[model samples]
Target chain A: MKGSGGARRAPRSTPRPRGRPPGRSSRDGVIAGRDALLAAAERAIARDGPRVTLDAIAAEAGVTKPILYRGVGDRDALVFALAERLTRRMTDQVAEQVARTEDPEDMLRRLVRGYLELAAAQRNLYLFVTAGGVGDKRLQQSLLLADGAAQQFVDGIAAFRSARGADPAVATVWSYGLVGSLHYVTLWWLREPSLELETVTEHITSLLWTGLRLEEPVD
Target chain B: MKGSGGARRAPRSTPRPRGRPPGRSSRDGVIAGRDALLAAAERAIARDGPRVTLDAIAAEAGVTKPILYRGVGDRDALVFALAERLTRRMTDQVAEQVARTEDPEDMLRRLVRGYLELAAAQRNLYLFVTAGGVGDKRLQQSLLLADGAAQQFVDGIAAFRSARGADPAVATVWSYGLVGSLHYVTLWWLREPSLELETVTEHITSLLWTGLRLEEPVD
Candidate 1:
């Protein structure tokens, strides 16, 4: 909610402009370089699961540890950046779908389905981001990323409800609750994808849909 | 579902039984000793959060690192044991409440209230157990604990719906989803605790109650 979620996304990895300063570290160059490194890191996570080390990430990027460090700071910083990137990508995908749909149930389906597909597609990376740990710093990082995603849902829900003259006062609580549900459900489902995607999505959609339409005051 | 969740509970830490042997380790002695160590570990977690060190745990138990190591295999093993203990305690609390309540809504309210209060009482300990980290091993431990809790809810839902003559086919999905919601909501609420307990519990109850009573099939 503090910053536009859209701004966090790096522009696509564009080719560096010709005649760039040979010995200068331009900001644009630095941003592009970091994006490329993150891309490499994503590939490594997809291949090696969440336990992929910084050394492996550097190797995957065809760079040394120092360069990797320079690109994304230390491991925690790298984790933060990766979390931001992934959350933003997910937000963008869901936003794109929301923009095209005015029906609340359809929007809910799109949001839930988008989340499931995104998590399933990046199973290892998602697991890497959410794997259990034991520390205050890790707790903060995990919450920070989750808050970002939840805020996006909050915004979407607010808009959805307001459009139909319904109070959106429960946006924050419901958004967090829904995100938590999606997260653990996706974690369980990824282990065994026996349940069809449509069925799971519909079940979730029905829950949220009915709950939202309740005549009882949410506030 | 595979095991009686009740069997997971270790008996109360009792004084060493009247000695049958003067110079050997007795099975009751071993059980009581480990339970004592686990109690000490719980105190440390309450005091120092999830990142409490083995040395600190050992000290809390009035023992040395080697003794702590001998009792619990390692840090991860200790974590696994603690998770089991906490999850089983939570399940028992909810199950007890469920047994007394004939009304499904009342049962759910009790379940949510019980979970929230228990989590609030062991704030640091709960956070320590749920903290995010690296490795598939950690993931497995976390999931194993969550699955246990989810299974308890599944059983509760199946019983509740069956008593009312409703098909309990969606109980598994609903159970996992509901557990995940409660887990994240509890995490968020513990940080703030601004909302009234009844309000939060009522909100969650309404969501689940309305959803579960849906006339449409989950499929």
Candidate 2:
């Protein structure tokens, strides 16, 4: 996550429930029932793969199958719903980090560390969002929004550079490169959960602050 | 890839079709049949999604479904076979690029362009490899080997900086960052097939070469 100077929320997702609709309910019933079903969907998905059936979630939610039907849509919709919730959480987390620091570079580093920690801790949600990277437009859009937010943080850096009258072209490339490098670190951190988040963050920040281009050693 | 850093013939993949069983000729019936199936896997995967069935693959191979059983084991085995072939091809491409260049930076840039091109051309394989990014040790090992090979070109940059006696520690991070930056750009290129691969390459290389790090812009 890069806290670009500006970031909007990721698109929402919904996981539909399966079953005949339960009888009509009051506004309170609708809210409570939907919440229960969604919670159940998350738990089932966490334990099993995303293919968890609606029956399992309905049972886990302590609601009748019809009640779930009244609350959520089909399995895919339910998955979508859960994904929407998680994606928003990540966006908010990134936004919150922005509020904490005005330094663009520090904000970017902190956002990367923050998201990597979340990815490490919530492996299931990480998989849910990333699994559909290329296949799903919704997933891609969600990520793009996140990236856009990240770019905003990098934009802040570029703005500072432009003010100093440094090469605007170089600043643009460096900002994109910074976002790209951080995404890789986040991917690695998600896959290798054992690696400490802060360590990887520090490693990335150090490198982005310097250039690796140099001459070969002569024998 | 990366010439296995001298670990030649190192097979990270499992359940691949063996060359021969005693008395079996190079073009034995079983071997030829398996090759046909493997090639069909490529075509079918290209035409369809990753979840295409073995029956479909065998049918695509123009042989009865039972013949596939003689070569690839179960669904997992079929997937493994397809992934193995793709991995080898990608690795070879990178190795060829790495060997062709003399300048360390050029080697890294060429490697990036090579990978980005491959990812664009082979959508199925790209998605399959990325899908295996988390929780799949075998795939991770294979990819790391592939990435490690890519990393070697960047490591050349690190080696150069080391020779200059300039922040050796920072050099390694910068090398990794450059590799990562290019890698993420490939992901973005997937969406817009017309994305200028060369433009991105030039943008990234310029940043690395120019030694510019942007600061926070306060309006």
Candidate 3:
């Protein structure tokens, strides 16, 4: 229902039929199959938390583990796919909010607040994709999300700095710092739910907006 | 030799002899055993990278896996112990640097530069202790290091704000933001080794010092 006409025409029950002929329509079917597996994976994570196994995800999809893996590769690949999905959604939401606001301060507050809200809403899935593994794969998955988010900011930041007659090279470092700070703050807030969302947002916005030094510069 | 007299007298090779008499000296023996195991873990991680197994670590310590487990608990516990050890050394270095500098800017630069240098020096161990695992244990372990670093900054930031007649409440959030930013920046730099340490430290310092807005405030 959500995809193109070709996808809609494909049978939902059997997205990829065995011994299917290779064609444009079949390619769409493959896409649909992968999407279905991802959707099932999200559901499984939501239901069973971060420890949800691939078997459980396959069961949720009404398919075998081989089918699930065939559709989405392995567990790490699935996590990367989920991370891509989540970060895309987050990026879209923040971009929408940024588009509506011209004020830099308001833009930052909206960005921070929107990020926290989305992360909190998808708390289980966020944990599932971001913190569910160890080693290089986990670090790569997290960096993928953070780097994607930072990429979205780089252009905007560069433009803003150029307009102000400042070096735009700082955009890369600043964007990474901002995104990383927000990422960790979200993790801390998720763990300590007692902290008010507004408090966290305002504090972050203030720190970024005015810098850490509250006193007037002697120079 | 590093510890008190009781620890010095304890046999380093056979730290905990089986059927040892129960006394204050034996308690010292237990402490020495744990330290020896931790040292072995550091050596193993340094040699084999983050994926170094408990068996490898035990072999490095010249003990069996059971002895290693008894001394350091499990893999997670060993990781935690290593994290604590690394963070303590980092904290001590930062504190020493802070003590030597009166200029706040210099202090911050020293902190950031020192952190990067230390992390680069022990890159394998850093990866081992920080990114070796996934799930709640990984998060908890990372948080332990971040929180410890943030704790060191809380008082300093609070006092700085108080002296300027600003509310000190922002200290907690600011400290976390600063530490988390540094943590991620270190991770990024570690991955992208082309970035110079001085360059990264300067950019972070400038970001924290002057913030994102490079122009004069309209207000």
Best prediction by TM-score: 3
A1-219: candidate 1 lDDT, tens digit per residue: 122346666668668674434654656445338989999999998888787888999999977787898988877777778888888898888778866887656877888899999988888878777662246556556554458766665555555445444333355555567777777777777876778898888767765666322343222
Query: In candidate 1, what are the lDDT values of residues B157-214, reduced to their tens digit?
Result: 5553454343333555556677777877777677667788877787666656663223
RMSD of each: 12.2, 11.9, 11.0
lDDT (Cα, tens digit) per residue for candidate 2, span B1-219: 112346467667778676534564545445446777788877887776544556777778876565677777655466566666765676689779778878766866677677777777887655544543223332233234234544555555656656555543344445446655655555555754453778766766655554345334445
TM-score of each: 0.75, 0.68, 0.82
Q: Which of the numbered candidates is closest to the native, going by highest lDDT? A: 3
By DockQ, the better pick of 1 and 3 is 3
Off-target runs (Cα >4 Å) in candidate 1 are A1-32, A132-134, A144-146, A150-169, A211-219, B1-28, B64-67, B98-100, B162-169, B211-219
Report the lDDT tens digits of candidate 3 across residue range A72-182. 887889989999999899999888987798887788889889999998998889887777655655656667666887656655655665655444446667776787777
lDDT per residue as tens, model 2, A1-219? 122446577966658865557865565445446767787777876776444556877778877666787787654466566667775676678778767986655766777677666666666655554443323333244344335545565556666566665544444445556655655555555555554567677767655654444334654
Between candidates 1 and 2, the TM-score winner: 1
Write model 3 residue lDDT over B47-142, tens digit each, in one string: 987878788999999877878878888788988999999999999987888779877778888888888899999988988777765555665676
Q: Is the docking of candidate 2 incorrect, acceptable, medium or high quality?
A: acceptable
Docking class of 1: incorrect
For each candidate, what is the lDDT? Answer: 0.71, 0.59, 0.76
TM-score of 3: 0.82
